[model samples]
Target: MDAFYASVELLRYPELRGQPVVIGGGRNATPDTLADGTRRFKRLRDYAGRGVVTTSTYEARALGVFSAMGMMKAAQLAPDAILLPTDFDSYRHYSRLFKEAVATFTTQIENRGIDEIYIDLSDLPGDPAETAARIKQAVRDATALSCSISVAPNKLLAKIGSELDKPDGLTILTAADVPPRIWPLPVRKVNGIGPKATEKLAAIGIETVGDLARADLELLQANFGRTYSAWLVEVAQGVDERPVVVSSEPKSMSRETTFERDLHPRQDRGELSAAFTDLCTRVADDLRRKGYEGRTVGIKLRYNDFSTVTRDLTVPLPTADAAEIRRAATECLKRVPLDRRLRLLGVRVTALLPAGSYIAEPQSVQGELPFAPD
Candidate 1:
């Protein structure tokens, strides 16, 4: 999907297409319909929040807006960008449509997330490029959205290749193209080479895929150890033997939100309480939907200065009741310092088991919220 969340929002308000649009605001950002049927949207300049960008249109991206960036920072970059609240329900509906469309071709699909997937076409009889085109068309026909795709020899290359083009891009990469095509790119472009690894690679004069590919094996081992060094070298050469996994299990479920403004635990108790309860409820709903029960509930708190802390509590039995998860999470919250204003809060459930396998039991939570006044 191209700018997925923002693209979906464009479908709802076509007039905003091609404009710098951002999707991460709260209910207050919802557009108002005037008597003449014109919609008035909130602008980034009008936003004053601790929230982060969820997704942005390419138009917004051109202005330096990107996901996970501070909303205030994005506003400074693209002050006129239209702001809209997120609608996960609609995004999920479109995700189902695109995945179902692709399933018509072959079931060799490995779902990476709501936005990305890996499809194995080696077993399918046909030109892989044509198959890729057909899949792209099917996705657009089904969802009225564009997706960037790449037909590569392996997952690593495919992942990197898919990102080579933007909006509606399709690139075909092969072993012959690794030297000319992939080598010139920065080492940071590789999936597993995250910020820390990139920094380490930079410090060692390995700036590009070509550098990593030609790097000394002994030097890499001395720096990153044999296991990771060997893996890095192989990835630089575009070798990924991992198969496209068709099914996988999740170990945990969680929900978290960054507030539009920092809320003092005591002064903003009502808002904090509402948001905390919402996170617990959503996490419980996720467990029930996925046929799982969790014995552990946890809480995450990020203070105004951006320092984060977490605590978890394990219950006697696994269950998916929202209240039980909330009760456990509240207990965890009691164990964290709340003297400062908070920018974010989260709830998580872990130690999962098949829902029916657990004996259902609800535990009572005593006392008011530790941060709140009764």
Candidate 2:
């Protein structure tokens, strides 16, 4: 899916096509419809908040705006860009449609995130390019959105190759293409390499995949340790043996939000209390929808200074009821200090058990909440 969130919004407001648009505003960003049958959208400069970019159109990307970047910063870069609120419900709907469409070709797909998947096409009998094109068309037909795809010999190459072209793209890679195609790219282009690793690699003059490939094994070992160094070397050589997992159980479910303004614990208790309640309710809804209950409930808090804290409590039994989850999370909350203003809040449920595995019984009453709702 290419610029998935923004593309979905484009379907609703085709007038905004070809323009730099951003998605991440609160519900207040919803466009107003005028009597003239025209839509009035908010602009990036009009945005004043702490949320990060969820996704942006390629036009906005060209202006240095991208996902997870500060909304204020994005405003400075693309102030005239159209701003829209986040719509996860619609995004998830199209996600299902696209995945179902692809299932018609092959079922050996590893679910990645809302917009990406790792597909095993080795058993499919077809030209790789043609097959990739068909998949792209299927996605567009099913969701009215374009998606870029790649058919590579391995996941590592496939991941990198998919983005080589933009909008709607189809790329094919073979083992013979690694040196001429992949080696010249920066080490940071490799998926698993992070900022820290990239910085260390730069210090040693190993800036590209080709450089890493020809680096001394002893030098790599001295810098990154034997296990990681060996792994890095193999990665440089385009070696990835991990199989595509068809399915797996989730370890936990959580919901969090960064605030538009730093919220004081004591001064903004009303707002923090509402946000905390909303997070708990949302997490509970997610658990019930997925047919799972959890024994552990937790809360995460990030201070205005960017420091963080988290605490969890194990209940007597797994449960997905909103009130139960909220109460347990409140217990976890009291164990931490709220002396500083908060920038973010989150609630999580873990130690999951399938809801159908056991009968949900009543929970024992606990003491009154030690603090206010937040």
Candidate 3:
């Protein structure tokens, strides 16, 4: 699933092949039909909104446009790039097609979101590389799309190997290749090493996987917690014991939106309130559709400057009522400092339980609420 969203768009507009394209615009960004019946797509230069890049083609990436980048900043880098609104339904359709195609080879597969997965091929007979090639061909046969595949002894190395090459890449690795292939890479390339941890590692002169592997255990534990430090050491040596999760349950459900224009909390209180309620309703609808009820309601706010904050409140009973979710989310919002104009708002439900297991009660009980930065 290389440049997944953009590649899917390319399938729809073949004429735009090899050209810079971005996906993130709203409905109005849809291409228009010309007098000659040819389609005219929107250009990034004309985009003026708070929308962020959902994905960009490799051509656009070369021009410095990337996923999660503000559309305005991306426009500054590749103003002439074609802009297209996201079509998630089509993406999901392709996702299902590819997964089913892969299932033809093995059912011991772990779905890692819509674009990626981990397959347990150890039990399967034949050369691992050949098997991966067959799987990749199956996906292309099913969806006419290309995907990168990595075959390694464990999940960690496999995940990193999959990213070593570009579109339609196939990489194979073994424990013997760890020192030569994985050691020199940046520490940030490790799965669990995030930005904050990477910065801390850099400050301590541990910038590469090799450095981390050689770092003192006590030093790493003092910087990171004991558990994370030990895990880091194990991963640097290409030792990941976690098995592929064959199935998973949803931890939370959420709905969020970025406004076309930033809205001041106080000045646009009425409008904001309506949007907030609508978000809660959507979250509740999602919970019901998924047959789950959540006890924790949370609100997320991203200001004009792109800083985000989240707050959550737990209730005594699990519920999927829109009004109840709205009430809890509203309470969570009160704990946040809304001094700046907000560009995005979101509502989330967590601590989920099966909808059939919990029955709504008339009694109201409040639980502990906490504010956290997201």
lDDT of each model, Cα atoms only?
0.92, 0.91, 0.92
Give Cα distance to truth, residue 280, candidate 3, Å. 3.3
Which candidate would rank higher by TM-score, 2 or 3? Answer: 2
TM-score of 2: 0.95
In order of appearance, the predictions have TM-scores of 0.93, 0.95, 0.86
Candidate 2 residue lDDT tens string, 132-160: 88989899999999999988988999998
Could you give candidate 3's per-residue lDDT for residues 1-374 as a string of tens digits?
88888989999999999999999999998999999989999999999987899999999999999999999999999999999999977998898999999999999999998899999998899999999999999999999999999999999999999989878999999999899999999999999899999999999999999999999999999999899999999999999998999978799999999999999988998888888888989899879877999989899999999999999998778989998898788788878998899999999999999897976768656554343222
Report the poorest 10 consecutive residues by lDDT, candidate 3: 365-374
- Collision count of model 2: 0
**Residue 204 of candidate 2: its Cα lDDT?**
95
* lDDT of candidate 1 at residue 48, scale 0 to 100: 85
